[model samples]
Target: MILEIAQLQVKPEQSADFEAAFAQAQRIIAAMPGYLGHELQRCVEQAGHYMLLVRWRTLDDHQVGFRQSAQYQEWRALLHHFYDPFPTVLHYEQVAL
Candidate 1:
């Protein structure tokens, strides 16, 4: 499985809208073929920061299947605008027991 971790720093005033948008976005990603599951959490210390964790059967499932879908365009339009300076998305392969 491929695990994705994204740290997004949203504009202070846009936090609520960002969450709403992300919820809608999650629906799109969740319906894809290789999706496992995902979660989004707000940082307690900093209200405008969020953590997006997602699991996929393969990296190509995300990079090609989901990201290229039309649903993603709408998702990007809604949530990407709320980013303060853009998020950093990293992929990982689990190595822990």
Candidate 2:
């Protein structure tokens, strides 16, 4: 499985709106193919920072299957404006401990 981590920096005073939008946006991603699960974590110390962790069956499932789909555009529209700059998304595979 692949884990996609997005570091999101939302605009100041927009956390409420961002979270509200994300509530709707999360459903869009959850319905996509290869979607395993996800979590949205808000930083206690930093009011406008968040961590979004998404699990996928494969890298392409997220990078290609989801990002390239029309649903992505909806996802973008629902939550993109709240971002100050933009979220940085990175994917990782579990390593043996």
Best by lDDT: 2
Question: Across residues 1-96, which tens digit of lDDT does each residue of candidate 2 receive?
Answer: 999999999996989999999999999999999999999999999879999999999999998999999999999999999988888899999998
Count of backbone clashes, every candidate in sequence: 0, 0
Error of 2 at 35 (Å): 0.1
Query: Model 2: runs farther than 4 Å from truth?
Result: none
Tell me the tens digit of each residue's lDDT in model 1 across 1-97.
9998999999989898888788778888889889999999899999799999999999999899888989778778878889988999999999997
Q: All candidates' lDDT scores?
A: 0.90, 0.95
Model 1 error, position 39 (Å):
0.4
TM-score of each: 0.94, 0.97
Candidate 2 residue 72 Cα shift, in angstroms, is 0.4
Q: Which window of ten consecutive residues has the lowest lDDT sum in model 1?
A: 17-26
Q: Model 2 misses residue 61 by how many Å?
A: 0.5
Candidate 2 has a TM-score of 0.97
Prediction RMSDs, each to the true structure: 0.9, 0.8
Residue 65 in model 2: lDDT: 99
